[model samples]
Target: MKLRPLLITASRWKQIQQPLYPWVVTVDRIMRHERLGNMPGPLVHLFSDYGGAHKESLYETTAVLYMDVDNSMPWQVERLRVRQHFLPDGRRMSFKGLNDVKKQQALIPFLQASDSIPGVLLVAAVHKSIKNLCWSKDVRPDWPSDRAMRHKWSPRTFERALHVSHLAGLMVGGLSNPGQEVFWFSDEDELFANPTASNDVGNLFTMFTSVYANHPFKQIGLGTTAIDEGDRYEEDHVALADLAAGSAADMLTELAKYAGHIPTKVAIEFPGEFSRKTEIITSWLGYSGGNLKKVMVVLEPQGKTGFSVMRLNW
Candidate 1:
């Protein structure tokens, strides 16, 4: 399917900032990689897996959401379990043979129509080149020999990306877990609300020490380096964050088509702790009253002269 189009207005372009420039650029880079194939192998693999018929499914699964379910609700648990394992389009499978599995399609709509749970989804996207560059310069001691040169991203490289994605996910999750013992983190439902939330926050900085890590703290005027990390991206909530990050990245790629300038990064996130007033949550599935919300933060280069747009739908 064709990507959703964005019509970036002057006001939207003005929202772009210096810190987000890296994210915008990375989205463009990844988009170029879509045609040129230069991104890290794992990411390229992810990009390749969602093509033709599977593209919408990728959009569904990858667009992670921060879900909150009542711990005592058994049906809610069962429904989520099904969603976690099955495809978003509801094509469950029974592997009858080594290479062939019976397809059981069309479960999601029924499930949603019958019993939909309420939760919030938070997501973000950013460009990796800036972080990659920052890593090679300040962190990667042996840049030339880094495995990423061979398109095999070093563990640190992968960790750095994962950490950033998870961090963004955590920031989004924090908004919804107001009073719950366990909060789902992503579409995969792997991670949850737990004590490790602090460790999850800490690991972000430890994994990637680029200017981006320090940028958030810097933006908030917190010069101290120590941070309390959140859960890994394996969680469903994190998957939503991944979805958001990926969606933002994808939209930025299309935006580059008309802007005539390669951006640094395009970060689309829920207004954080400071911007609570701007946070808006609407029912995404009609009358279900699902605690779903969508945040669209647009930005452009500091002194650029053009505007373009891209759209990411859930």
Candidate 2:
């Protein structure tokens, strides 16, 4: 994409030197390499979903998928075909909902088809141990004392911040176009429990990119929808991100058990027998080509106060 790189100011550069620095660098590299020379349409659509919030897992994941299509009809048509073949009863497709091995295998070809959809999938997996660190004050210094104190005690608050930060990071790194508008759709969660919270999230996103990325969208719009009541077109995109996030969490959780120690970087390999969900995601990632690209980054604790970022390769 003939996009301009974000101009990080001296002050922003200081913040970038924090724990999330490695992740930002990784994202920039992936975006520049994969999206170079690809012109985006007038509008860019970003669909997002998150997973691995439970305390049992070692990481929480946020997945964002962006496409530069002026017309979404092609994507909708393929979504309908996949739904008719796999779920004709109006049931929604989800990562956790795919149970039967044969059905998962059957769905692989459709997901792997080059004509299915055109977009780039970005997944951010953050270690749960990050909650113990006190870096939010540096990340968002404008927060009032009461809010900052709450974040210090509330894991959910910390998670919401991480989610927004990663979303903003991906947008600045991957989807930077001068006059191109952005429409972001996210699955309903505690992050957007009410209209006021939703607006706050939107404002935070805009402010984040403006201050840290030194790039802001011409017009940024945000929407939230429940999984059961959402429009099919929106749901399909969100479901793709949901699958990716959940699959990454599953694989990383298993990998954590096997690694036992944090290495500087570790290439991702399925260390054990794959579940139906992992198998489907693995097949999809392995076969992704032609206008569709996928990248996964994991941020794990490096020391008492630092983090290491590693790109996960299939």
Candidate 3:
């Protein structure tokens, strides 16, 4: 089959104040490694809950969003949370706030409309409006923009992530070798109110960390040293090392298998105290050999930007 044309929009979500430790570094690392020329065209859209960044970063974001957009198309985006406006066709853009509910609220319509575009991918901070959102009837995923999204965001397993990814793929006629992508963020059928078993969360993180440890794959990006705003594309990159000993997936799968059913909620939970769980989960996942762990921008660094307790896994 011919390679696909895909557009990806990924935002690093944060609910904390301190620096984004190992996770953002990981995301940056992965993004720097995001060189998928095999496909027709690739565009990346990235945003962050934390703002006040230099224009260089902001400009990069705009450039990515504008890539491949027909110069004459009527493409405009108004982001309230970031206090920015985008008219890629016109090359006009502006940003407003770091955390404004009104601004964030406005994006709902835009997100709902995204599925209509062919091959368009949407990865953002998990918003209730976005989560509970239902697309308009006229919108379908078969569009070129939506099709691009389906090509990239497909899942890696039988989890909810896979459900969402596959749904998008099916919507846009996007198919990789059936086994290539199995990830789905989740399906509405699996979208009921989450059931939080007290210890289940902790166990979930511990298990995934183990999988990372034992998995044969290494992070596609280079992990860097600890720093506020860690180096963007550091000089030296290391291939990921082996885990201490065992793999987490093997045990967890067995745990689930013994139950004779898939787990509806297998979360990597945190201490009973905090409302935001990303950093907490990231830390827990770090039990791997590496002192500083790597995750995505979704998780916080708990004050340390480059120094995380969790190790990066494959």
Candidate 4:
């Protein structure tokens, strides 16, 4: 099957600092483009395609849910890796395979888009590498686990599952990341890529900190939302419809009103067909916030999802 054949302009292709996501999302990325020929960084193999194993399929779906949980520490790290192309100390993104016309076309605008967000940058190393993430088990993801499918469930196990999935998902997330610029889709017609600069992230955090000064909502990463100009999934909200309704602006606007309350949860809700598990609950560390509970992820064959609730009286 042929896709819409998305491509970037020639000028833009000549100066891409990071490989944008369209290459990763497309069915196959292995092309003869010359851009991929000169990559220079600590080379870490990317797990682009999924395996035919039960666990492999559930990786992304389960991982996103795991991060959504309230307590998880959201680390803001520089999103770059070394590929087998450029010089070892290379700060700029060097590629060789993307030298072809079509591939270059795809890379140009992605770089253009990269210019808007300042949160990303080159790096000497990262705390964790791509090999770290990939938490999948035989248990179904779209539905509840059998042991605690009903009301009587264990919060500890649920969190364990989430942590496992999160670690796995982070591996892939870090690899494909064009940097801190989260490509967001908004319902009203906005395509956002979180600024990659530390200042940009700090600015965002400061803005939220001031607005949410009184609200318990501790601002996490430069939050984002969806715009209607959607075609494919990048990250964050994978499903198109989920990109609608809510946007970074909307959430900020709403949260501004609740500055006086304890920020139990920062609502980053989006529209249509959002992650089936709108909210993920887990206690992987074997502890919860008393009100904390268990999160069950049941993965269906083609990536369908279901949820379960567990109450732990700690």
Please report, in order, the local distance difference test score of every candidate based on alpha carbons. 0.29, 0.62, 0.22, 0.22
lDDT tens readout by residue for model 2, 183-295: 77888876676666666667656655554444556787778655336346677777788888888787777777777633454344434766767766856765545556776
Clashes of each: 45, 4, 41, 61
Estimate the TM-score of every prediction: 0.35, 0.78, 0.21, 0.18
Residues 1-314, model 1: lDDT tens digits: 12323433221011112232244453332222221111111110000000011232111112333333332144345545555555444332211111222122323332342233233332333222223323434445643442232233455434443434433433222222222222222221112123343234234323232322322221111111012132111322232233234434444444444444333244333222311111111122212233233433323333343332232332
- Best first by TM-score, ranked: 2, 1, 3, 4
Worst 10 residues of 2 by lDDT: 10-19
* RMSD score of candidate 2 (Å): 6.3
Model 3, 180-285: lDDT tens digits are 2111111112222233221222232233322222222221111112211322111001001001001122222222235432222233322233212222222233
Q: What is the lDDT of residue 292 in candidate 3?
A: 21
Candidate 4 per-residue lDDT, tens place, 1-314, comes to: 01112234221012222322222222112111111112122221210111112221212212121112212112111112111122123222212223444433433333322222212111010011111111234323533342222222234333333332222223223222222222111211111223332233233233322331222322223223332233222222221112111111122222223342112223232232312111111111122222212111112111123221111111
Q: Please report, as a residue range, the 10-residue window in candidate 1 with the lowest summed lDDT.
A: 43-52
Best by TM-score: 2
Name the lDDT value of residue 65 in candidate 3: 12
Clashes of 1: 45
TM-score of 2: 0.78
- Candidate 2 displacement at residue 236 in angstroms: 0.8
Runs off by more than 4 Å, candidate 1: 1-64, 71-117, 132-248, 259-290, 296-314
